[model samples]
Target chain A: MSATRRIRFTLNGQAAAAEIGTHETLVEVLRDRFALFGARESCSQGLCGCCTVLVDGHAVSGCLFLAAAADGVKIQTIEGLASGERLDPVQEAFLECGAFQCGFCTPGFILMTRQLLDENPAPSEDEIRHYLSGNLCRCGAYPEIIEAVKLASHKVKSRTPGGAAP
Target chain B: MTPFDLVEPPSLGEALKLLEPDDSAVRPLAGGTALMLLMKSGFFRPKRLVSLRAAGERLARIRIEPNGELRIGAMVRLAALEWAPEVRRDFPVIGHTLRTLANVRVRNVATLGGHLAHADPHSDLPPVLIALGACLVLAGPRGERAVPVEGFATGHYETVCKGDELIVEATIPPLGRRRAAYAKCTTRSADDWPALGIAVAWDDDGAIRSPRIVLGAATERPTRLKAAEALIAGRTLDGALLTRAGEAAAEEADVVADARGSVSYKKQLVKVYVARALRAAGAGPAAP
Candidate 1:
């Protein structure tokens, strides 16, 4: 039998720890160990972005990333998009734009969208498509997802000081 | 997934000490993008995994030496390399290839050393790195040694990297006035792996001085078209010369039929893309 390792990392905004096997992926640990089921485990390969999460403020596939490797890293999952009752601007925009159909890939899109908005508050249409191309939507909700990103970008900028829609 | 012991060594020296040349069961883990998949699929069943993230800050940094050479650490993520200003300005081909290497998510964590060591035939970096004349640095119990990227990969999913040796960094000399262009032909969207990839570079005179023509993804490893390069050397870049050079590249490439494409189909792609890449490099840098 293989020995288990204790991993310490920041999940959402809280410090978290888990005793997991060396081979366990972040998606498995997140969904099974900690019961944070926001990130889906569709395609375990890195090709699919269903397991996308923010690692150190950048989006990455959780399924392809080992849980033990995430020690001391700050990770943001789909469950963290809302604070208490208030939803993040991206989350709010996702709903307003009706960005999901089957909803299996919504969490990944939301997390990736959050990352995009955080990095570039104002991204062009080409930039948006280029960035989000990794995350696949099986329900063909990409059109709405793109719209959500645009809407969220506007909402996010409007709330910032000295920022307004041009 | 199979069970394995995880050892997080605090330094490169310590990690080296933990490795043994005869211990094939001990594997070094970096980024975990490709390795994890293999482990999960039961294709690789290593008994122990040495985590390199514990090598700390030094191994993760991309350094520009005083001599203007670029040293990319083994742990520097692909996304970081893609947007790095030095890479964009000095080695734009590296950045250009990185943009289309994989999707945004994979780039966020996949590292250069891991990618090179992984040595997947369809990967984008090996061909470009070989074209740039980059050297890979490997550290082990015997200390560090350098190997040219061209000779790094021995076969599919294989490299000169021994079980005890770990790829620590890749150093690239200054490009100077040389301009490079890379073209990839994928079966589907841009996100898919290349069915055929072509990387071409030329000197300031634009006369194919020390020309490098590489065709990737069609063979077991990145194949250099030395004959094609020789044919174009000292010759002006023109449609006729380029088409002849492309035909030579197609002939030299040992293409194999796979799910991505057929052997003849890939050879045809190599012929067209080699010429297209040479023209593109001669024209100017395409917008990233």
Candidate 2:
């Protein structure tokens, strides 16, 4: 075993710290230390996006990223997307569209959608499919997920002046 | 898991010191995408990992020099390059390849240097870099040296990069009037490495110049087809010429079987994609 190193970063709007092994991935750090169970570890490799999280406001795979590499960076899991009493528009859409079945892949999908909206507020069906390709839905809820993303895009657009239509 | 010490070098100099000849056990760690996967599979067992993220020298930046050459930092993320105005304007083919690399999430994390160093025959960057006639700047304990992209990778995951050296940047000469395109054959729209990829570029004079062709995932290392290039050089491209060049490329590439596709299937795809890329490059600029 190797000596653990100190890792410091902002987690879900709070300053967080952990002593992580060099080999420990961010997914392990989130699930094991910080207890952010929302970031699932389905594939453990990068193939499955179950461990996806937002780093510096961009979606990235937590499984392949070293915990130590995130030092001083801002990280957000699915748990961070919502306010104390309100759901993010993406979460609301997912719920309305029944975009998830097993719910294991929902967190990653939500985070990915958040990134998509950040970059392109109003994406077409093809654009949504292209952006969300990293997040796999083993339960085959893709059509519903696409619908949910469209719904969320509309919801987001209504709030912004001159936003692209759904 | 085999134990290894982790060293986070604060600067390139310190990283090079850690990677000195005496410490053959030290390996510079970049994005950790391929290295981590190889480690998980027990393919490599380095005693120490010198993290390059903090070294300041490994991050992304694109600047046009006084001579008009574009200097790209090796550590630049694929996603950043995809949106860079300079790259999109001058090298749209590179931008296209970046947009199609794996997926958005991977693009956000995979660095150019990491991708190049990984030297996976199936990777998208090698062939593109070769076509651009890019030069790699490497820093090591012995100091810095430059190597052309064409001769950079020796075989498989192997590279001319010494264990103590780190690829700092890649410099690309301006493409004044050359047209270029990259095409890949993959089963899915996302998250799939190309079974075969081809990048083609030609100079402005209506005559073929710098006819670079690289076939990925078809050999242990990305192989350049000089014979095919010779066949196309100084000649105007057409369907017949493209077919002959594709045939020559297929013959030059050492396609092999992997979990993704069969050897014959990959070779066929290489020929097809090469022809397609050539045709696309020959099509010239789009209407404004």
Candidate 3:
């Protein structure tokens, strides 16, 4: 055993720092140091997406990442999706559609969807299902979740004004 | 969870030095996808972890050599491969496999070397890499040496790599006109390791040259089905030939029973996926 190492990175939009052990997971660090409880720790084996987060704009499981690996990287947790109290369109759609049942898996679903839309603005139904395949909704709210993503796609496309529908 | 010292080595040289002692209580940490879970579950207890993150440059780049071989940095995440244009254009099969791998989140952090080194029977990389005739470049006190992917995994959760050696990159020979495909049978669309995976590739002239067939989650380590491959090599693929190849693969593989599927079911799946992959490799009719 050794003293914890100091790690520095960008969390959401702010500079973040934490002292963590070599074996500490990103989910543990995010939940403990920054108090971002949104990155849940369910099934810490990386089997479940309850610990999903965005690292450098790419979705990843926090439980599978070493805390030290986040050094100098840009991270976006569920809390980072909003800007000045305005929820991101995907978040709003999830809420409007009641896509979450237990809410325990909402953050992971939201983050996964954000990554999916960023890569493909208007993904097909099959693509949406494929991309969100890792984030398990044990409560079986899949239909609502798919509908919410479709609604969010429409909202994003319509707001582009003259942009073509994705 | 047990606490341990974290050392971020700035380069591969430094990382190897940290593991120089054959019995040193240190492990090289990659994506930590498997390592993290193992540690958390109390399966692995190392005194120190040499973080490979600082060796970032070594892991993020993909280069093609003048000899027409493709070199992938050991650290290249699975997601990066899925999104890389060159990989998609030249090695569409690689992208296809990555796309089906666990999930988007896992792909974002899981590194190629880590996955290969983990040597899990059900892992997605081994079968594909072996089929592509890929080789791994390892660096250590003994300097760099290349090992064929087929011989890299010695057994379940085991590899030929020495404790001090670090996998720096993987080299995949160009496919040129060869068409390739990968198919797997799993319980779910994501997060579950395959019950059985099959990879197939053939050379130009459509003669089924350089045929390599592999099966995962069926044995202690991902293995090549030489008997099945022998059935098609140097012969033009036809309906009867493809069926015979699939049967040979099923007979050659040592499939084990798991929760996802039974041994008998896996044997059937081996035949089905092998046939499908061969057909998908352009052995069958094309869309009208």
Candidate 4:
């Protein structure tokens, strides 16, 4: 069975193309074809959020996502979060809160937090915990991660026009 | 995962034509979450996959009919289904159950059809759907046929669907005056697969009538707790009645042991969660 496919998609706000085997997962393609290592695959299974990527503005496990399925979609990885030399607000909050110890799982946690804040700008502690439950940090930095999410929420709200009070 | 030919069929007719009726190696792919897991593990080596992602928007619409029946297209994502106002307003049990399913990312990609078609008995939706008397419309080369969700799965990872057939949509009847709830007992994390899952529903104007209790995850298939349903049929729910119903469910279910728990442990969970589900359903439908 020969199933090599060519897919074109918008990556990190730029149009890109890749010739991938039908069997190759999106994470594999992202790392191999585009040299984007921010979205690394730790747990090949979808249970771990280590491979989270945004497809059309929704989070999906890239390890389980077939590269051939990336055609005609807008994909965002952790690498796409920062512009030029400035870090996204979520990245700043994570660094300020010291949310990671090993940093292997940092990219995934940060990406998930970005989505969480996009959905709920002012999430309560319980809401934040519930949303981030899918992600796991082996360093056991959950307390700090929660703090980072709260900080990021505040940072995001402040950046919004006239909604800084939250 | 071995390399396999992938065909992106633009329509359901083209997708169905791509699938060989007797070839198990040729299969339809929807959402790709569940199948990707199988492919990664090498347990399933598909010769050809008919990708349904481009198979038209008719497979993605969620319509609430005038009769209040929910006609959910097979390809509707779980997260969309969870957040749909019509679902939360009419079928709150579905919304409540989905809130605790696998996780946000999986929910965003996994479709309702794949969830049922995969027939992973540990899933939360089947038992809940069985309790609500949901029906699946299976489209095949011949035509479409409707099957009740209760007997759709014959065993773990087994279903009545033929190799060539694809689930087109799921139709949930109007909840009307009945209240329903699903209770799952996860031995590990809160979002982990349940050691035991119990879904119960019935008419609740004054007395419980036509009570449907289905136990899942702890069993081979979604098993109806007929003895338990019969136990509480015409009675107003009270503590004593709830205990008796729970006991009946625990005795009637044919639970099997796995990583989730042992047979004895799951039997105990069955007793506890059955009562919890009935109590929750009796407390009245949840607020939107």
Candidate 5:
């Protein structure tokens, strides 16, 4: 097999390109190649959300996503969530709520909630629960995780200029 | 995962040209959610992984035709369909199914055509699409052809699609005045693959129409409960009729035992879910 594929995509808002093999997944390239270690790789099947990342503003399982297929797409990892000295609202809420114990699943949950709140700023309790159902917290931190999302929603809503877009 | 050459043909025509009708080694990558999983498990090792991203916008649109039909491009993401105003307005069941089918992460990347092509009997979309009278459009080096959703899947992880052919889009007919409902019973979480699923569509008067019932995830294929359909074809749905139809559905499906449940258990679940789906579709008041 020839590793002749070169993919050009936007990573954390910057143009990036990498030589990839057809078998290489997004998680491998992100953690192994670029050293973006935030997106955890566990249960490589799409089942576990540990490897979740934002591809063009939508959350996707990095382990199940082919880096070669992501050519020309925008990718956001947990490493990109914080800006210099400030944490993203989702990250702040997660920490504030103590949403992680072991924290292996924290990055995936944070990213999922970020996208969730972005899409629906004022999601109801059921909506929040339903949206985060895929991102499992093995530490049994679901109650706090749910709380974090609720708090993050309020934080996001207040920060929006007119609170029009979620 | 075994390594393979990544081929990106800029246009649909170029992609088709690269695909040969008899070459099973050339696999087209859609959202890569399902395909990637199989590759990770070492189940699928392709000689060439054809990335359709180069096809770009040509295969990524969702169009509501003037004739009241909904035309969805193959590459349209599941999340896009879940939020599409036209899809939500016309076929709300699809939106309902999408919400619980998989997690937000999977939906955001999983494509419509890839979902169908994966052809998993336990999928949430197949039965609903079959009940909605949808058709899948396939384009190949030879030519283009359309297959009704009901006849698309030939078996588990299989379809009528030729190796050279790629699913272009799927067209669902207008819902018109018919009300539809989908009921999926999972062994574990609500998001898990259904142990048994029932999708029922009927007219305003509760009379069964051209398009009818389909039981999914409980059988090898999207099994149309024709015996149950015949039981209520011309009758206005009532509690008794739905109960009777449910029984017919259980008898019609060729259920097999699995981790989800035993064969007999699934049959029983099918009966109950079918009745529940019928009632949800406004099959009159429930029997006392």
Candidate 6:
């Protein structure tokens, strides 16, 4: 394709199209084209997971991922985690546990916790710490975040049949 | 980041033809994690990037050959390596190395080929690959050639790979009776780039044989501690032998200082981590 090319993909479930530069990052495209602000870029480097997004059901750093690479993949973001009225179990757990103070990194932590629990229905404290180590919470609410992840695991397990949405 | 034309080649052959041996600005783009970082900071500017994402499944399969060697395609994501039953069952040391490599997000998107091709001295995988006696198959316009992982990287962020040559696959020999362990010291977070990395693999025939000790991160490149390996070879791995080997490794390594640590501190780290990794492998593979 040319320097700026059109790419078509499913964003948060709806089919979308955008003309993105080859150098444009997925985070820039989501925020600029889709007005999706949940995935904010804190550290341009992949070190801080604030710009975390799900590409084809796998978590990836939006900051490092090229927008051109998202052409045919299904993308999910923090904005898409909740349905019309119901919040995701992880989000509910985060709210109930007050897992964040500044809240700049809450969306990333919640999204990552969702992925972790999906892969591991029940993760030990050590596992939780290890999995979420990439996403930083400068507010220093790590203990409560761990508690929230555990609570979310229980809530997710106890949900009624078919309550889980893809 | 400057604008550039991104071309998606449908197959490995076409991708190679699209590459230019003399043009550094025209590069083959794999996972794009490391390259994106450099581009964002204005370290590198590119004219075109030949994306290999759609380049068929030939470079994405993890298959065990008839001879019991594991052939991992270059485009195989790091997460696939972590979750692959064959990798976890046979080469558990690789699994151990991936556990603390970056994080779930990076592993989900970053490819194994990019990790080695980047050749960052602080990377954790090259030393592990070298210790396992791995070989990388590089494909170019001329043909394909195999290079040992030890010599694949020449210096920090440098490799013997020509601009037109692309790594197609990495072949790791079956573990057999050899058990391996990798230990790294991260100065910041546990997942941060290592300050010192030590990987040891020895054929445990009830005693250490053909022991391979490789040191990384603390040195300019992944290097084999030949003196230490010779001393430990054909010897039983005991407490005293482990201590002496650690000292020998520290003395033999060409350690250089970086922001991560001072040269003296890394030498000490080499001493400690070498013994620690040897002890872990000395326990033997718990399963077999």
Ranking 2 against 4 by TM-score, winner = 4
Segments of candidate 6 deviating more than 4 angstroms: A160-166, B286-288
Residues forming the 10-long window of minimal summed lDDT in candidate 1 chain B:
B279-288
The worst-scoring run of ten residues by lDDT in candidate 3 chain B lies at B279-288
Tens digits of per-residue lDDT for model 3 on A12-115?
99998888876678988998888899999898777678999899998888887878778889999999889989999999999999998999999999988888
Query: DockQ scores for all the models shown?
Result: 0.72, 0.61, 0.72, 0.80, 0.73, 0.79
Q: For residues B1-288, write the lDDT of model 1, one tens digit per residue.
A: 888888888999998887766877788888888888888898898888888887867789897898878999999999899999988877888888888888988888889878988899999988888888889899887788999999799889988888878888899887876778899988976688889888887675645688898878889999899999999989988889988998998888889999998988888998999989998888884323
lDDT of 6 by residue, B97-202 (tens): 9999988999998999999889998888898999889999998888999999989999988999999899999999988889899998899886788898899998
Candidate 3, lDDT over the whole model: 0.84
Question: What's the C-alpha lDDT at position A4 in model 5?
Answer: 59
Candidate 6 - CAPRI tier?
medium
CAPRI band of model 1?
Answer: medium
Summing lDDT over every window of 10 consecutive residues in candidate 4 chain B, give the lowest-scoring window.
B279-288
TM-score of the first chain alone, every candidate = 0.95, 0.93, 0.94, 0.96, 0.95, 0.95
Worst 10 residues of 5 chain B by lDDT: B279-288
TM-scores across all candidates?
A: 0.95, 0.94, 0.95, 0.97, 0.95, 0.97
Docking class of 3: medium
- After superposition on all CA atoms, what RMSD does each candidate show versus the true structure? 2.1, 2.3, 2.4, 1.5, 3.0, 2.1
- Tell how far residue A9 is off in model 3, in angstroms: 1.9
Candidate 5 all-Cα RMSD? 3.0
User: Which candidate leads in DockQ?
Assistant: 4
DockQ-based ranking: 4, 6, 5, 1, 3, 2
Q: Candidate 5 — which pairs collide?
A: none
Give the Cα lDDT of each candidate.
0.86, 0.83, 0.84, 0.91, 0.85, 0.91
TM-score, candidate 3, is 0.95
